[model samples]
Structure formats: structure tokens, C-alpha cells
Target: MPASISMDENMGFQYGVSRPGLNPPIQFGNGFYGAGSGLIRGGLGAYGKKICGSSSQYVQSNISKYFSDPQYYFQVNSHYVGNKLKIILFPFLHRGHWTRMTEPVGGRLSYNPPITDIHAPDLYIPFMTFATYLVLAGISLGLSGKFSPEAINWQFVKGMVGWLLQVMLLKASLSSLGGGEAPLLDMIAYTGYTFTGLCVAVLGRITLSYAYYLIIIWTSMCSGIFLAKTIKITLYAEINSYDANMHHYLLLAFPRNSNPKPRDSQNRRETISLIQKCKQFHQVPPIHAKIIRYFQVQDPFVVFELLRLCSNLNSIDHATKIFQQIQTPNVYLYTALINGFVSTGFCLDAIRVYCRMDNESVSPDNYAVTSVLKACGFGLALEEGRGVHAQVLKLGLSSNRSVRMKLLNLYGKCGEFEHARRVFDEMPDRDVVASTVMITSFADYGLIEEAIGVFNRARSKDTVC
Candidate 1:
């Protein structure tokens, strides 16, 4: 029988005897326990391994098992099946363990799935539908004389096409979930779908036709659903990888085992070299520039990293001074400063930075808008928030989803339910974000019934909760 080890409050492991009848190598981590059993099982008192002769066989068997019994299927077998499917679909999902798992139990036997070309039918269908709609809408607009021949900038169209290509490149680099191995292709399909939908909407809005607006809205809803699902899958994949890594580390450092430590050797040298390269490429320069011919073309991402490093080193003054030197401070820069100040309970400083943005005519974007609104929500400066709202409207940014959401939140904070409702009613599209903002607003203001009503309405509209 495999021994069971449980950790104490201090994370010290204690061994427990497992009965012979019980599965061995039963692993427990965080709050969950799993047992392995069956032909591949080591009688290790761990989780049972669901066996499959082939990948297709595995998928078919698992699906049958799941749909056949709803209650016990997911409860008992879903995790293994889901994990296996993830591996089959995205072989690189678990880099280290995948290699180990595929290796033979004892001999040199190797098990690997055949490389198969996969295409996304779900993506293709929506893409084709949206493309058809765009073509029709564009033709309609052209015939209606809404698109003036001289007004049409082929350059802008070219730029938009370039933007689509850039988006595909970005999606591929980011390892977007739905795209998987064919991220570039997947992103291209998604971009086509999004472009067509937006084009149709633009055509409709230009023509001021309600029917076109209705079509645009319907298409948007469908697109949003697909986007949300893609995001969900990506997030799920990330979380699973994180959990697997944690488990692998825990297993390696099992009871009384010292955590692995790094050594100053060739490996360390390689690591340091990599870190320096990353800093050079990805790190932002210090906010301060000492009249260098031109500021080093550092990555904007480096700024956050530098700030984090400064914070860790307790060089608050240095961080602050660097932040002050930013030429065109964006929402991210302001938010970082605001967050640092708020964390240190320097509410006044946070407010001052917010005011500075307006004074400098920088025009606070969504992040800045949200931070200030949050400060108001906490009853720090309701009057200041109201002023920001006026500025937002004057900038003609009130219609932006982010700004509107912030405004909705601010109105709720001020206990102005009517104002919040007006903002909600004014939104061109009542998306999940809009609905959530309203629901959260009601909940925050102790309006339970109103929150529930908002939730019900959202559900009725098929806005996934």
C-alpha cells in the first residue's frame, strides 16, 4: 500500500498509513485529494488512471461516460477526461509532465499521438456569416451614396488590413486559446469576423437605419459569445497549467524535502544572461532622462517592472521621482502611481495625480477614470468624481464602454440611482460589462432587490452571468 502524507498548518508533512484495499499513492494538494488506480496504477493510493487504447477511443469513451451519467460522471471522471482532452488538443499544455507521462511505466516504450491537422469549424462558420453580411452592407451603403468616392481613403482601408495582420501576429504570440497551434490562422478568422461585424455596424450607423442597427446588434451578440468562450478556454488552460506546476513542485519537494535552490554555475550564468537580455528588451527606462541624445527605446512594459522593483527595494522616493518624469503619462502610469499611493494610504496624493492629469489636458482614459471613480465609491471625494464626469462628457468619451461603466459606478456610489439608470439606458450596447456594472452598483448600494432584478434581466437577455 502507498503511504499518504498530509501537511500540517506550518506545511510540515506527516505520513499516514493506507489500508491495503485503498488505492496507493493517493496525492493530496492544497485542499483536494486524488487517487490513482487500474492497470497502470502502482497501487500507490493515488488517483485512478482512466485507460484508453487510442486518442479517439479516449474522447469517445469519455464523452459517453460523461453524458451517460450527469451526476457521477463529472464528479468522479470529468477531471481526468478533461485533462486528457486538453493534452490531446493542446499537447504543449503541460510541457514537463507530458514528456514524463508519455514515457513507459518501466520499459523504453513510448506512447505519442499521431500529428493530425485540425481546423476550427466553429470559427469558420461565424467568419463566413459575418463576411457575407459585411459585403452586403458595404454594397448597400455604396449604392445608397453614403460612402462618397472621394471620402473613401484606400490608405485607411489598407491600414485596417494591416491592423488585422498585426492582431493575428499578436494573438499568435499571446498563444490565444481558441487558436491553439494555428493561432495565426485562428486570429485571421476571428479578425475577419470582427471586421465584417464592425463594418456592417458602421454602415448601419452612417445610414441611420434601425434595421441595420438591429442586424449589427445581433451579430455583435453572437461575436461576443464566441469571444467570451475563447477567453474562458484560454483562462482555463492557464489555470490548469499553473495548478499542474504547483502540484509537480509539491511532489518533488515531498515530506521533509528541502525546496530546490539555485546554484551559481553555468546554469546560473545562462539565467543571468537571459534576465539581462529580457531587461534590455522588455524593461522600461527610468522615468528620469538625463538629456541622452534620445531616450533609450525601452519597452513600455519595463516601466511597470521597474516600478515593482523600486517598490520591493523600498525606494519610494526614487519610484515617485521617476514617475513624475513621464512625458505623456497614460492611464497605466497614472494607475500605478495611484495604486502605490492608495496602498500606502496616501489618498491625497492619489487625488492630486488625478487632478494633475486634467490640469495638463492629458485626458484621463478608462483606467484613470475608474481609479478616480473607485476613490469616490469609497467616499473619498465625491465632488472630485463629479468634476471628472463633466470632463469625460466634454471629451465625448462618456459613450465609451469603460467610461460609461465608471460613470455608472460613480453614480451608484453617490447614491444617485436615477443617474445610474440614465447612464445604463444611454449605453448603445447593453453588454455583459454594462450589466455587471449596473448589478454591482445596485449591490454596493445595498439594493438587493434591484441587483436581483438586474441579474434576472441580464439572464433573460441571454447575457451569460
Candidate 2:
């Protein structure tokens, strides 16, 4: 205590300034209070030692459900053979709408072949093809005068081992990313499909020796495409990436001692959950800061989610700002931004983004094509819309149902009924959406009688949009 200082109201606690002719106290009092508080905490801890044990067990018990969440379980059913082959051959045609049955059913389709399923795992095709491949290999070996029982057996084992290695690689990669609860059998089913492509490649090798290389290349590409599409639809979205930000530098120093397994997954889930909450709880600036703190903004999934939330919240300006923050945006991220702009009635902005994406040499997906087409219709950029239609044709996306629907509606809305009618007539499978779009186009172009005919022909008109 200073001799010149007093605890009276007139001589209050002087902090920074020199009181009239008064010397300041040497003690700050903070350290003394802190020491007293530490002693009190220590005393309490010592006293509670007998009653309280380490809380690690308590926390382990409390959070067991989070680690064992049912949502993380990757279920599989593979009791079908026929339609499963169709799925492996052409996944792009998968409409992705599974049918449901209420009463007890009796067929393989009932258990394994979901009516409109896109990515369900199946074993029948792959296993049968593997056996057929062995037979084909034996035949080839016999024809080439290299046939031996031991050699044939070795070839079969080698193929199976290779398949197992592929399964293990995919499983390990997916598991580290918070997926791979899918069963070993489910993975075997997936990896074994490669044999079907191999069987075809062998036939080509036997029939046309010089063209075998072309056949091999084509079959390899198809196999790659099949695997990519299946994994994208089924497992890719289920996985989440860990944060690799510099904030974990200390954790890096003491690796094993500081970091726990599931630490990254927990952090990822928490960060995404926080970002989701920001659409409701925080304004754009705080949310932006939170995002920068938590995630890689350029990650397509994170960008997509943020853009989606911003659009849902009607914050198109914030989405634009976020889109600008991306360094090298991919097609999906660009589509998200374009969708936000188009959905909020910023048609010109959507078109501008589409152009920017084009100049970046990024090819748009079906969603982007449909979205930009709608934007063109709304903006009444008829020539620009026609140019996009030509681009769609050149890109081979003219066959896409959504793209067709958008093109027809765009033409009709711009008073080009002939183009709309051509688009409608060219559809190979004229379903409910196509029919509805045709009707709308006809009405927009003052063809009421044609609209009525389309309305009468449309089946299941419930989901016209």
C-alpha cells in the first residue's frame, strides 16, 4: 500500500495517472489476488480428491453415443443378380429414386433391388463375372498351348488377390475420411466388377490381336468410370475431410501425446454444424470469419454448403463474396454460386457467373446448364440462351432431362415455339416432367389446344415441377 493513497471516495483508486504530488503503490494487487485464488482452488482440489476421480471415464461414458452413431453405419444388401448388372454397366441412367413396399414381399427385388436405387451394393454380378473370367482365362490358356491346372489355379488366386487389394485400398482411404462402415463383402462386390471388363478385354485380345490395346484402354476407362460413379453416388459424400490448418502446429509437435483418434472427425462435424448454425445465428461477417477459422473455403463440399445456406437465407450478396474468396473454383462450386444467383432472381448475375466459369475453362454440370438456361429465359437473353443450347449440344448434355426441360421452357418463354416443340418431340422417354414442361411451353406460346393435349397425355401429374 502507498502511504499517499487513501480508500476514500474523494481519493479513489488511481490507475494510470499521477495524483497531485502522490507516489504510486508498488504492488498491483492482481498477483496477490491470483495467488490467493490459486491456493483456494488447490485446497478445494485436495479436499475433493477422495470424492472425485479422473473425469476421463465420465466423459467416455457420456460421449459413447456420438462415436457409435447409427447415421455412420453403412448398410448393405446384395441378394439380387439381374438388375444389379444393369446398375454396374450404366449408373448415369440411375434416376436415384428408390421405391418402397409396405407389405411383406417375396422376390430378390424386394430385398436387394430397390425400385429406383442408384448406389446399392450387390455381389451377384461381380462374383459370377469373376468365375466366368476364370473360365475364359482357362480357355485362352488352352488355345495358346499354355494350359495347366496349377497355372489356371494361380491365375484365379491372383485375380482374387488383386480384387482384395483394391477393396482394402478403398476401404482404408474411406475409413480415414469418416466412412467405410460398409461391410467387407460390400467392398468385395464393388471391386470384383473389374473382372467383367477384363473378360471383354480378353475376347478382344483373342479376336483382334492388333486392336487389343484399344480394347484394353476402353475397358479400363469403363471400369474407372463405373467405380468413380458408384463411389461418388454412394460413399464420397458420406466422408468428411479433416482440418489441416496451422492452428494445430502444437499438436503436430507432440503428435502422439497431444492428438487423439477421432479428434479430426469430431472437429469436422463440429465445424460443419457450426457453419450450418451460422445461417440462423450470425450475420455474414461473423459467419465468414467462423468459416475461415474452421474450414478450407475452396473445398467444393464446404463451398456448396455455404452457398446453399446463404441462398436459403436469401443472402445472395454474401454468397457472391464467398464465391469471390475461392482461389480455383471447380464446376460444382461454380454451379452453387450460379444457383444462388439464379434462385434469388439475380438472372444477369447468374449469366455473368456462367460466362466467368466458361472463361475459366470449367465445364458446367447438368445442374449448372439447367440453372443458366433458366437464367437466360428470365433475363430474356434469347441469342445468348440459343448459344448455350448449342454449347449443350456440343458437350453432349442435350440428352439430359433437366437440360431438355429448361431448353424447351426457355424457347417457349422467348416466343420460339418451334424450338420448344422440337425439344419435346425429341425426348426418348417423355415422362411427367417433360410433358408438364411441354404444356407450359405451349401455353406460354399461346398454343392452348396443344397444352391441353399434353396435359391429357401426362401420367402421374403430381410432381410436374
Q: Give the whole-model CA lDDT for all candidates, comma-separated.
A: 0.46, 0.59
Q: Which RMSD does model 1 reach against the true structure? A: 28.3
Least well predicted 10-residue stretch by lDDT in candidate 2: 102-111
Prediction RMSDs, each to the true structure? 28.3, 27.1
Best by lDDT: 2
- Residue by residue across 1-465, what tens digits does model 1's lDDT show? 001111111211111222232222322222112211211122112211111123345455435533442332122233443453343223433443112112221111122221211112123333444555545555665877766544355534654676577565556645543323332333443444455455656666656666776867765665555444443333233223322222123233343234333333554344333334432211212122211112211223445544444443333333454564455656677676665554443333454556555445556676777766665444334445556677677667786787777778777766678988998989888888888878887887789999999889889988855
User: How many clashing residue pairs are found in candidate 2?
Assistant: 0
Q: Which portions of model 1 miss their true places by more than 4 Å?
A: 1-305, 308-317, 325-332, 342-347
Model 1 TM: 0.33
Evaluated with TM-score, which candidate comes out highest?
2
